[model samples]
Target: MVGIGYRKDFAEEFSENTLNPAFIEVAPENWINVGGYYKKMFDKILEKYPLFVHGLSLSVGSPEGIDVAFVKQVKQFLDETKAVEYSEHLSFSKCENAHLFDLLPIPFTEDAVKNVSKNIRQVQDILERKIAIEIVSYYTPIAPEISEIDFINSIVSEADCNLLLDVNNVYVNGFNHQYNPKEFIPKLDLSKVKYIHMAGHTKVASDLIIDTHGENIIDPVYDLFQFTMELMQRDVPILLERDFNIPELEVLQHEMDRLQIIKTNALKQHKHAIIS
Candidate 1:
């Protein structure tokens, strides 16, 4: 299945007969406490489709630690909306009292791993749900002490949490950090992956691929998504993100159609493998 993030710009474009998405995702922060037109719009969508919350401000890896109050509020929002899943980035977006406003790579150290795992456990307790952590696209590691795959696996295993695999991040990191994206995949605990995300990035330089999510889904990112589906050997719902410079609703529908085709073909391959 394929879905797109909820955006107010195209709010009017969504309805039962028009550009129907398998699901709709929104940042809970965007709808936690808004009123009037936006609230009604969201309500309408909720009536028709499955809702998923892709969180933005949890800052799970922040040294400042998890915010108990915010987690409670998010839980309340989830309860109200009856969202199926909630996901936040594994990287930290804050330090001390200052909001960095960008996802920063957590240091690759055993101490960092322990801290992040503890935070995830606390969040799970508060939310009363298993929250998936997204793999973020980052330019550099805080330290060269551990491989990215090891850092991720250690935290998820320790916390006993699910993963929100982002194919675009894998492609961007592979290019920026000089590694085969597929090689990184086998090291990961695929059993933990709950869903997948794919988006577009900007190739500013030959070696620097920045995850912008503002452009069209590039060929490489789609290739990576297809590769991931083959590895999983089953159907998993995928969400397309366009947080910046979002195009028309029709364009997103077109992308969704393409994704559906990929998933259809992948499932057929999987069935053949099982039968043979």
Candidate 2:
């Protein structure tokens, strides 16, 4: 099913079309203990639609170690909201005690994989639910001791966690890092894919692309999305992420319609393959 990120900029707009989305993804950090008007608003909406927690501060790859207290708070929030899944970046956002407020690339190494896997296991034990890790977009690799695909595969396999595949990131990283995005798609462990994120990026240069969700979904990204849908043997929740410059709800509804068409077509193709 197609979904969208819940942002306050278009809250009232979303209220009008409650049935348009299959689900809504929210950043737990934004509403963990929110009270008053916003809390009431969210609670009312929660009664209507399912929420998937896409976390911003888990800092899973932090060498400084995972935050136990924060994880407990997240667990409480998830239990309270009945969110179906909790997903965070495979990258780190903190070092030492300082909160960097940005997802940073983790080193592509065996030691880093071990550290991240341990962190995921701890989080899963605390939350009593399987966690999904988003494959992030980075302009540069921190430590290129291993290929990007292998690093990601090892982490999810060792952690025994699900994947939140971000298609735009694949396109951006492929352009900036000089790799075939299509080739990278099949290398992923499709069995672990639970969620998909599709967004637009900015082309600052002929060779550089930034994963900025401010713009509309571009043609190439749409092509990538179609390719992804055609490959998946199972249905996974796909979400449109627009963090800034959000247009009218109607504009988003159009995109949702497009996604529905793609999903329908993909399912037919998958079925034909099975029959053949």
TM-score of each: 0.97, 0.97
Q: Against the unseen true structure, what C-alpha lDDT does each candidate score?
A: 0.88, 0.90
Candidate 2: segments with Cα more than 4 A from true spot: none
- Clash count of each predicted structure: 0, 0
- Tell me the tens digit of each residue's lDDT in model 2 across 1-276: 898898877777677764388889999999987888767777888998899999989999999889999999999999999999899999999898788988899999999999999999999999999999999999888967999999999999999999999999999999999999999999999889999998888888888888889888888888988898898867889898989888777778778778778878888899998899
- Best candidate, lDDT-wise? 2
Candidate 1 CA-lDDT value: 0.88
Give per-residue lDDT, candidate 2, residue 266. 88
